[model samples]
Target: MGWPYLGETLQLYSQDPNIFFSAKQKRYGEIFKTHILGYPCVMLTSPEATRFVLVSHAQLFKPSYPKSKEKMIGPHALFFHQGNYHSQLRKLVQSSLNLNSLHKLIPDMEAIAISALDSWAGREVINTFHEMKKLSFDVGILSVFGLLDESHRENLKENYCIVDKGYNSFPTNIPGTTYHRALLARKRLKQIMSEIIYEREEKKIMEKDLLGYFLNFKDEKGRVLSKDQISDNIIGVLFAAQDTTASVLTWILKYLHNDQKLLEAVTAEQKAIYEANEGGRRPLTWAQTRNMPLTYRVILESLRMASVISFTFREAVVDVEYNGYLIPKGWKVMPLFRNIHHNPEFFSDPLDFDPSRFEVAPKPNTFMPFGNGAHACPGNELAKLEILVLIHHLVTKFRWEVVGSQSGIEYGPFPVPQHGLPARFWKESNHHYRH
Candidate 1:
């Protein structure tokens, strides 16, 4: 069987996974050929092949895909940079998202999560996705950007969505187009950031937030980053930090709703922790989250089953030989994460939603929710903290039920519930109850 043209097939495959699974099985087997906007692309499904593309031979590949920049929040952001430029920018961004800094941000994260929970305590129905999205946005603004004003927070949330829609639109800046609107949105966001930057510079506010760190960051030449550079980097961090966390948390809640036994186990774990910290003197700490081994396993499992980023594309910067296949330069190589995650050889009953798959022996390099190699997501640790904290609060404070009795979820570019995930929330009447 040979490859097919990039038209209805690609669109259909992206929108509908059953069709994609069938195509992968019948047409291309494990590896397939396709095109994105008329560019040659090879989609590798096998774990070994994906590992080769993403990790082993990563240097030969670069994330230079045409839509990479546009699909991200803006051009020249961290996602699009290459080589030394990428390395340098990644270092500066890493300062704020590093382990120590992420630990410091946990107190702020808990406050945001708790505030959201308190607001929805007596509500009959709520959208967990929307709640989590707002929680994440608030955290990003407060912890990352050091912006705590209510009006500013609301404005950033609105502007961020517009920018996200713009990035997902086709890369065109024509009037009345999504991209055009995104440009306007970007300009608004930039203007806001410019004012913030100016104030920080003028007032010499030496706070500990991400913006503060960036303001003080200096290159090897002892030069501060330009205003445009600061704006681009800030946009990159905000985009990377916000939506990806929301998607993962949303999926975790969905999986917990579907599996009653798992949900019971997770809820029990939360109760144990809450009871242990009886005094309100200490909130759920980062160390405590780290101690929740079951929670971590569940998160990893959800990431494998409901991968937010379905496939990752890297352009072959040079001809490479892998497992006797000659991958020529300039070919767009896609690491088909869905296939690798569900491969029976690496994961037993790969289709089943089982967190125990990660309990015994780890699944090698096959499970890469944060991707692998040099260009891996820099905010991976922060994302994990966001998930753990949100889950902790939800499982401990309230109970939820999925709107439908569907067995599985639908796949968007990112996996989302086919029916909007509607759930009722209530305070746990019996706080000391055991599972």
Candidate 2:
């Protein structure tokens, strides 16, 4: 319906995507019909409409992804499941990653944070984006596949880079293309997972990592997940945890650097928590994540200002009408995350960075950095805790300042500091802050 079959696809890719969305919202208003990525789409930005599509009328829509991603993650991937299957997979994933059980993971999480920050201090300049991914990937590998040898874990991280690139690439299978390489990388990961699974089975060991749960648990059909399913879901978890969390962590660094006042306040909050524990350097606990209410507020505020995933896409399985507009069946229904996030109607002076706005909760469905409804991220708590732990350690132990002239953020899928957030970090030794 827009610009031939290409529709408004080029418009999206032409500039800062938020700029395009802002312009379109100014001209068309919210909930306008447009064509994107060769499909008819009805974009929803208001909280009511987002709630309608994501939760209220969710049954009328189904999750969809680009061909490149589907091929990369594979046909049996947990992401493709719906209804009961989706619920079952969600439970299995939650059993290990959810907040209620995260206490068991605090030791590993703290160790990862200390090691990463200590290493970063050795360098004259640390790139925020690269360092966050390394930490996030390390935590994911530790909690999800702790039994694997260090070499295999590094191999997994290496192939993950290729697979991630293909995620946003065009669906071309031609040799020398990123897509081809991504497919090849996926194959290598699968081979590694197969060998690991074989080794675990041969030893009759029932480990406690996410992979161990998948390797041993049976679904309602009374069947264990195949190695292919295990590998595909591992890909799902890794992809989910890696860049998204990294993006948040990178933004946290920039925010703290920009506001020394807020950093001091957050640091004081953590210092109390850190010194409160016996021996002063013990690992955090799951329940303790709630102790730093301000840190969580800053993280939430950052999410609102710049969401990692700009929109959530679903295909309408049936005609659905909202506020007198009809979204036809087979159309793509995209919930513009930022539109609602930055909406003046929902957030007063939405452009301002005010963590105190979250001093109280935003209206229901008004804030969903992690998305809402049935498809909400199961690992949301895990990601939050990881961020909290890292921020806690970094703030209490070191002081940082932005090193270069950053041009601000640019979106490649999600927003990132155009400069990669180069920063000079100093490890604190005095164990105290001066007012």
Candidate 3:
């Protein structure tokens, strides 16, 4: 804690968050207390502590966020709740994103990737993370609605972008403010979702997508979900999918671009698949996507390196004790995923960009790129599939170069390369892969 009331809020926000958290862990050990954003928080860095808060004793903690964020993303979003509601919604979301269902989206996902890459080829330098966000948004829509009509898709994207821009802004609700505009846009999104829901209901059309799962669900009490509930969960999933995936994808590109040898190896792995698919004439199979061990390791390393979701907020539901320490009720508990990922005790040469280290599985609870326990990202598989499909097309068909001297990270609430790794891409020549 720092000055009165303000506490350490300024210190936490004034410097790089990683530096702030890492310094605290260095000075005070794995579990330390601090005050920020007007709340006393216990930041946990050790794997055991993280597991206690997120898994083993999760019942004693509840997910917490600022009131403004809850309102913007929808109060009924699944992550914002626990107990029966969270469990039931998680089941539906998990079922929708299950392997069997995601496998079906491969062809469509590939097309989205190709289209995105094609749009950027030979163009002026573009922000890779920003472009990846659009790609991720399209994939999110595909997973949620399963081929929604073009007009409705465009409408949702437009309004969602406005809401996203305002999400992390100052929470002032005055007219003309980003947060205020986000509120208005969120209303428009609800209206658009209402229309889509009405159409689905009127047609009694139920496909095996997230929306389908939500629409068809009935709890043990025979209670059906309301329109607001359906819309909120759908928006929640989209919000979850967009930035995190894009940021990781952006980091993957930067990492690959910076290491030519690694880039060549990943390119070779993808080229074998490219040739197996008859030089892009055939679609990528689920098996092909699964077998890219090298590429998969690169992805794992990127996720660990970036740790986009550095930490998560949970509040003690009741006074809790762990290993002789007392956590008073109402105190916020944060599991520092980034600190654990970068910890030397857990990962040797933690600062190096080494994908080979993943050859052996990580120790229990040490590698939680998506998080841990009941609240781990349900769409993680889908997110990975989207990344694989895009990388398959990108490496096999396009060559890109980072366009600036960018060696720093920026946190737009998620760590992404400075200026989103401004870069240019060109279609790879057919003969480029020939010996």
State each model's CA lDDT, in order.
Answer: 0.75, 0.84, 0.93
Candidate 1 lDDT, 1-435, residue by residue in tens:
124555444564455564565466566587777666556778888777877877787788888656635444556676776777678788876877777777878788888888888887788677766776777778777666764667666777788888777775677757998877877888888788887778778988887777877788777788887777777877888877776777788888888887888888988787788888882247877679889888899999988887787788788999988777778899989887777777777888887999988888656677888877778888888788888887888887776677655444554346666544667777776665554
The model with the greater lDDT, 2 or 3, is 3
lDDT of candidate 3 over 29-131, digit per residue (tens): 9899999888999999999999988999999999999999999999999999999999999999999999899899999999999999999998999999999
Give the count of colliding residue pairs in each prediction. Answer: 0, 0, 0
What TM-score would candidate 3 get against the native? 0.98
Ranked candidates, highest lDDT first? 3, 2, 1
Indicate which candidate wins on lDDT.
Answer: 3
Model 2 earns a TM-score of: 0.96
Q: Is candidate 1 or candidate 3 better by TM-score?
A: 3
Pairs that collide, model 1:
none
TM-score (C-alpha) between model 1 and the true structure? 0.91
- Indicate which candidate wins on TM-score: 3
